[model samples]
Target: MARTPSAMKYHRQSEKRRLDNRARKSTIRTFTKKALAAADSGDVDAAAKYQKVVQGLVDRAAKGSTLHKNTAARRKARLAKRINAAKASQGSA
Candidate 1:
């Protein structure tokens, strides 16, 4: 439905960006799960490591405009809180 060449090009670019952003979000979710799993299993070290990785990824995604800055910050905060709670509840946070 894009009649103009410029419009067609813009559509292609948007489609590509959509796929890339989707993949980026999926990766963030995967790492988040890993971090949560590590925390639930009481592995403080692994949880912290994965948390760091997720934070970096989220930051990058936000910087690249794939995620909003506030959303990224909120996610990082919630994940850290969950990890901390999991560790503390394990008796040696």
Candidate 2:
């Protein structure tokens, strides 16, 4: 319900940005899930590779404002920890 021309334009821009942000966030989540699945399956090498990809995606999302910087860092840390733990368990067994 934007009455003014500028307001209407702004609304359109915002809608586009919203869709783009949602897509980026979805992609980040998918990468994170893939990394975790690899870790859970005890494929340390594959998990590490996926974790690197996830880290890059998260960093890009944070830089672009799709995700908070701290949130991205925290997620990266958690993923790395999980990967390390998987590696440790694999080594011990």
Candidate 3:
């Protein structure tokens, strides 16, 4: 489909980048789920640790342009809120 050499090279690069981005996105989702699970279990320490990992993943995704910075911030905020709520509930109980 690519007529020029540069176009062919770009097509190949695009395919590789797509695969890499998909992997990174899946990894980010996995970390997010881990954090949420920890929060659900009411494990404050584990939730905090997983939240840190999620934050790192979000930051990397935003930095790499795979995810928008605002979107990443929003996700981090939501996850942090959940973790904090779990911590508070555990403290009270």
Best by TM-score: 2
Q: lDDT winner among the candidates?
A: 1
lDDT of 2 at 51: 91
- Cα lDDT tens digits, model 3, 1-93, are 999999999999999989988999999899889889989987789889988998998899899878999999999999999999998899899
C-alpha RMSD between model 3 and the true structure:
0.9
For candidate 1, the clash count comes to: 0
Who is ahead in lDDT, 1 or 3?
Answer: 1
Per-residue lDDT of 36 in model 1: 97
- The list of candidate 2 runs beyond 4 A from truth reads none
Predict model 2's lDDT versus the native: 0.93
lDDT value, residue 19 of candidate 1: 99
Better of 2 and 3 by lDDT: 2
What does the lDDT read for residue 45 in candidate 2? 91
Model 1, residue 70: C-alpha shift (Å): 0.5
Per-residue lDDT over 1-93 for candidate 2, one digit per residue giving the tens place of the 0 to 100 score: 999999999999999999999999999889889999999998889899999999999999899878999999999999999999999999999
Error of 1 at 41 (Å): 1.2
lDDT of 1 at 90: 86
What lDDT would each prediction earn against the true structure?
A: 0.96, 0.93, 0.91
Return the lDDT, model 1, position 4.
Answer: 98
